[model samples]
Target chain A: MTTFETSVPAIEPTGSLSDSVKIHGLLAEFETPGDILKAAEQVRQAGYRWWDCCTPFPVHGLDRAMGIKPTILPIMVFFAGLTGLIAAFVLQAFTNSSGMSVWAMVWVTGYPYLISGKPLLSIPAFIPVIFELTILFAALTSVFGMLTMNGLPRLNHPLLGNDRFRRATDDRFYIVIEARDPKFFRTRTEAFLESLGAVAVEEVQD
Target chain B: MSSIRADQVGGRIVDNTTEVPGTRAPLVLNMTTFGQVTAQVAKVSEAGRAPLAWYVAFAGSLGLLGLLGVCVLYLIFTGVGVWGLNTPVAWAYDITNFVFWVGIGHAGTLISAILFLFRQKWRTGINRFAEAMTIFAVMCAGIFPGIHVGRVWVVYWLFPLPNQMEMWPQFRSPLLWDVFAVGTYFTVSLLFWYTGLIPDLATLRDRAKGRLQQVAYGLFALGWRGSNRHWHRYERAYLLLAALSTPLVLSVHSVVSFDFAVSQLPGWHTTIFPPYFVAGAIFSGFAMVVTLAVPAREMFGLKNLITLRHLDNMNKVILVTGSMVGYAYSMEFFIAWYSGALYEKFAFVNRAFGQYWWAYLLMVSCNVITPQLFWFKAIRTSIPLMFFLSLVVNVGMWFERFVIIVSSLANDFLPSSWEFFTPTWVDIGTMAGAFGLFFTLFLLFCRFLPMIAMAEVKMVMPAANAHHDEDGHHHGTPAPATGGPS
Candidate 1:
């Protein structure tokens, strides 16, 4: 596969923009990694930084093309789990000790079975319930945190409406040169994408 | 299937190479795929006798279940006296079968919830079937205790409610604790299992041939759209439920153990029972998984996903749990001897060399010695051996319950009360019926439902872009293309 090269011009968006800005950027599809890398390098050489690549499966070097970094879900999950443990402990202590007053009063008044010297408030026995609650909370927090951070429950997306995108479920690859990218100008980016060996390029509207 | 290398791609491949066209490999089949259902059904029926064999098995299980139904009706119409549940053996087959079926149900949670929490991917293939097993087994188990109390109509008395019968189920009673534990376990397991099934059900719904099929699968599918948003929330909710379920798995079994351990019965009272019973529950549960999975995998043409690797993993678990159970058995003996209580010593000794020596030997052989063969790679991987050993473990575990319930009660504190507990036709018949109920439901489940979790299998496929190593984000390859013939 020969690498595709393109040039891109910078265009910063204002709080608002002209209706003439309606010229939507398009996506380029590729069938191989060499094609993507060569196209990315050519686009860089062309001074355009407005393109993205999508595939049915994540390509190993796709991040380099996009300049993305690792996420912090693991660290967030760690702290969330830690918080769950602390919450469980505090909840148990407050509920068992201070909240036992009514139970203590009722028992002392009406039902007193004298056994040996086991205390009425046994913290040790309550540890099992507390441990279970801690794991329960930690698991819930981490999972929910993952969902929220990932932006879930979105029933629809503009991407889903595209017929060509159907292959995303089975086998296909695509890269969109968004107009919002810093070095995006429709004509220049389109020219750059053409040089990058995109089989077909079609504009995606907002 | 042909393998395409990056070198074969036109020019230097792009940064993310696309799919090589016309190379979708056929799905693999094995023990984990169809086992008793598809695989065995595939083999025995291959001589063109499978339909006949299925008919025979179905008819046999149905007849046995019918007999069991008769036995149950007889017991309810007459009394508990239909079984040989005399004074010393009051617990008899009802309690034994109760514990037996509950133990059988344990594998479902172990395979699904526990394994999922551990991030074991192989669980996807087997968890569906195991969860179904858990539900049916629990159904069988729940029946025994419900009718064990003579007035079967008032079994609701165990429920904690304010009513005309103005009495509360004693919170202190282990039996009440059992009610809560079993009920909670069943509900939670059912929810977890069904939640996992929603997406798969949608797959089935879309492919159903008729309206009734559509409605049945559609209702259960809950309108799953396979959208990123639904998946995101579904994943989160599933994880939360799984987390909730993990402790419940341990607590539920521990509570069941307490049913015996909390009792003043000399052999029953032991601190080790909780973990011991839990391990044994898992042991027998895994055994059942293997017994069912091996055949299901083969029959269903799911060998690739449910691969030999999965079978090896399950075998290893069985060996570990089997050993743990063996250790518990020894510990009980040591504690009995060290305590120097005559009753305890007698309970321990009589268990090994007494009149019920056959039961003791069966327990040791099945739960302890039988699983040891798994130390050999051949035995672990060999389908036939695993199936036979699973039966051994099942029979062994049943005897373990028998030895515990009968031996301890038949010759307890008073010698005059000693009597050999014998199971009458009703006792044997009801047990057969429970098996019938279990198989009948299982056979029906297999006929419907995606026997394999199609979406989950696709997720784990090497080509499915489920994981992004750089960003730690898994948009997951779009939902897999469905309706492929096996």
Candidate 2:
């Protein structure tokens, strides 16, 4: 393991499985969250952009340790919520207060409903629907935005095929650095991960 | 902890849940491990057969659910006349049940959202099932409103839809606001609950033995690899959902209250209705949670996870919210007298001394008197006492709604319109069936889904602490943290 350096050429890891199968990544498994956190910090320091730490639960500060940036999900949700607010306002105004008409699946017109001779376009009356829609849209967007961003609901993932990596959702911690990463030299990266105190390292396949 | 434990005033054994003043008690007791938490939660779902009690409970619930189905079918075939809906007492058991079930749903959201916001890690133990309860309670609630419409076929008219009638729902109506509010609440709560279920479902997927379990858990698990990069976004989304649900839960009750508050009736028309309803909802919701949780923990062998501390904390919430509800009741009376409104005064007096005096008394006794018993540490921690009290509080809350709706609507200002609201057998059956529906759904959920949030429990484990750099082995004994809920 000490014979290789970071600049070593990309050598395919051998003697683990059939060479015919393509390698997807190198999976370094650790026993506890602390071991993984230690490895993740060093991996981040080494500047591996295409690597990730997998754990049973979210390890606090692991994102910072891995040099991950804050998510832009809130900004996206805010705009989605804003869209809901405006849509609710428009929906209520068009159907209840405004004289304007438009086609939305069918011809729609503002009825200007006069309740007890109260003022038309009651902002106070419109508020509950607006608030509900905003929360509704923002909530739905947060879930879907997260799923879309995370590339979820797929039938399979390469990491799921690795038996040693199965503990990633259990007691063990893992660091998966894909072969797609430029810094990922098959044997050398395995050596680097082993040096970081991984209990067991396995080759993941596509 | 030692100081408190040593000063046993009467030599009575103090449960670990009792306040120790300065020490942080670990959330998980009996030295649980990460793998064990996953195993304990996952095993219940994966077991080939549920226990005999589950079967009995399910059969009974399923029977009640069938009764609910029969009641709905009868009501649909035989109009709203099947129930005792007189002129003035148009809204009796239906609205009461609707509000009661919706109020019960609030506790779950409060646990999962508000507690999460406040960093109450103890919520992790109970949030999954609590959220499940919320969903089921809302489902039960939704049925009443839809069925109560009588012409159930055109119930969609409640929504702003372009129909053959060429008419839209009145957006200004508080009833329409109710439609929007409850709809939004149900959708958001489902999403929030499912989001929390994802990682736990992944655990079930990983541990799955049968083909059916694998495909089912796997599909819902959604290929979640639990990458830290994903966790970053997932956590943020959870935080956002929590932020969204906190206000959403509060708003749902407020909007529901507006259905009554905006009315011309004295008891129904009040500004305090919004906050009062919210507090009552939380109070009743916590009671319902305790009632369900007491048996669930024992039945599923989750006593260590859903500890006495969690129950004690929930009881404290019940006490606080219950006191708030009591205050609102007294305030309503004060306002009625202070405003010099004759109808309002009569509404208050009639509520206590009129035809439905018994219902008002029960509400006050169950909601106000019973919950005050929680002020005692001994009563709060005792499982049996809390469980009984929880059931009592649930009844009290329902009667509270009954007194509010029926009494207000029944004893109208015009004596000619005044009528006593009496529920026929169908009405009683529907309410019972609603419980059956709630429990049936809940039982199914407990049987199929990961009833506890395994991932969340593991996150709070002492071994998960960052300071344990020496933990190269999986079984490294954790040094208990001084960081539990104060």
Candidate 3:
């Protein structure tokens, strides 16, 4: 019976830094994947750890050039799946197996009943529920793990302000070295990117 | 020209002009550059409006959806008695429809998950389309079971939540397993589908001209910037999810089969039901995909992207799975006669020659006999013939469920309860309306979203700009040595 409206504040590009808007990074556009890969290798060798290459699709070997390490998501999923399997077994056993309990008087939480002369705690019957829960937990872990690792749901990023940077998802590739990086200098980074055959270099404001 | 020996062609270095023996057809036809792949797919979504045929189809689907809504409301007001369910045949059309729709949902996961694990690149072209179909088919499947409970408002009792009565769901019941299996299947499927759609949504967001489109597509894109670091982790997560989904696909249908196999009924109790049902599910699911893709590719002018090769591959799958289903049918009869139980023997015999003989004959003709035509290359390659055969498979699959449910239940072991079962108008109306719901959702998807996976199709193209050598000299060119081996 209620509705809520959440709107993202519009990003305005003024080409100047103000209190509310500071230089977030320098974005360089490359016309080809090879050019971007060459530039990324240079950036990595130049010891810029906070830089990344963006492409329309996953450029093979670009991860090696950018020096990104493998993720630990598979381990997280495995543990989450194990937790689900154990939890399902415990839940079923507690709910279906009758045992004496100490309350004000002796009572039983589980009212066990027999069907087709099977045992009260049937592991065979419990297997399906366990399997389903395992998958459910593992799947949930992977999706949420991905989102958290990617720092998503922030709803806003400074790179989105630049119109030319939008081509990162379309037909162009980019290399952006954040302003927060230790080795980054606006003019020097722009010059380096240009030396690596960047067609355009622009500043991203926060 | 008279007789060029193998040694004459540079000794095992064959010329480019000569055709190689037993070489497979190219997965992607009309090899184009990366930018062209983007432009071709993006143009469909970027077009200001859909074509006239799309509008016409959408309108027709909406009309059927409205009819479905009416039938559902009427069914809710009146009870399950409005269906043709009687003493012996209580699970007639509703259960049949539920099983049929659920079976139809299996092919999407098979293509997206199983084929991906095997490194089949051809699946990239049509995986998105099939996955969407799976979601919609599951939606239709969920409806039948939800409404069949009669007291729809109390359906939450299916879950094992704490209540004032202090009673829990019977953990021993396969029906309860159905709840969790299908529930998890739907959730994971939706997550997988949305995850795959994110990059494409980002592409749509960047290309959007209007402010509203930008905000909507941007919200779903979740600020995806195509960073190499993100893609690295994203690819790992995608593969892990695919591995998880592969087993989920087998488990979901196996649990559905458990709904029957676990029971003590004469015809329903069998060990073969799990694999038989899974094979049938993929068979029907592929049929539904072909039924949809043929018209969609033609109408959207996507012949180059979804080529004849894709259709041929799908037909091959249908051929294999259809044969598996046929084998299961014969094995069921042989086992029934070999069991030495009078009830089981009569169950098999009555299915083919008893009161519901027509349903059995139709199921056999449509499912087992019709699909064997795909063995001919000419029949498989012809567009119109494949489309018609796909529809026939659909009809046959529906009757297969009908025969399994109705024929078994129409005559029990007790002679006192033997009777005939028939459907009421409401049964027929509701079944037709489910199609209305399916097509309505599918048409909306076609109109609004990118039907084909654009980013994926680009990855498979010849000119996607990958570095093949350490020197980085080799880029976006086919390797010369690739023709030497398989």
**lDDT, residue B84, candidate 2:** 88
Q: What would the TM-scores of all predictions be?
A: 0.69, 0.93, 0.90
lDDT of 1 by residue, B426-482 (tens): 999998899999988876676565556555554444333323123454232222222
Q: Which ten residues in a row have the lowest lDDT in candidate 3 chain B?
A: B477-486
| Least accurate 10 contiguous residues by lDDT in model 3 chain A | A1-10
Q: Which residues of candidate 3, in runs, are more than 4 Å off? A: A1-21, A99-108, B1-25, B468-486
Better of 2 and 3 by TM-score: 2
- Report the poorest 10 consecutive residues by lDDT, candidate 2 chain B: B477-486
* Local accuracy of candidate 2 as per-residue lDDT tens digits, B1-486: 122212222224324585556755567766445887888888888888998889999999999999999999999999999998899988999999999999999999999999999999899999999999999999999999999999999888888877665678888899999999999999999999999999988888888888888899999999998888889899999999999999999999999999999999989999999999999999999999999999998888888789899999999999999999999999999999999999999999999999999999999999999999998999999999999999999999999999999999988889988888778999999999999999999999999998889899888777787654443534322222212110
Best by DockQ: 2
lDDT-based ranking, best first? 2, 3, 1
User: Model 1 chain B: which ten-residue window has the lowest total lDDT?
Assistant: B477-486
What DockQ does model 1 achieve?
A: 0.05
Model 3, span A127-193: residue lDDT tens? 9999999999999999889888988755777788789988888779999888777677767888988
Candidate 3, B1-486: lDDT as tens digits: 122222233223322222356543344555445566667677877789888999999889888888889888888998989899999898989989999999999999999999999988889889998999999999999999899999898889998765656577899999999999999999888888888888899988888999998999899999988877788778888898899999999988899999989988888999999999999999999999999999999988877778777888899899999999999999999999999999999999999999889989999999899889999988888899999999999999999989888888888889899878889989998999999999999988887788888778777654454542233354332222111001
Q: Is candidate 1 or candidate 3 better by TM-score?
A: 3
Question: Over 4 Å off in model 2, which ranges?
Answer: A1-19, A98-100, B1-14, B469-486
Single-chain TM-score of chain A, each candidate: 0.65, 0.88, 0.84
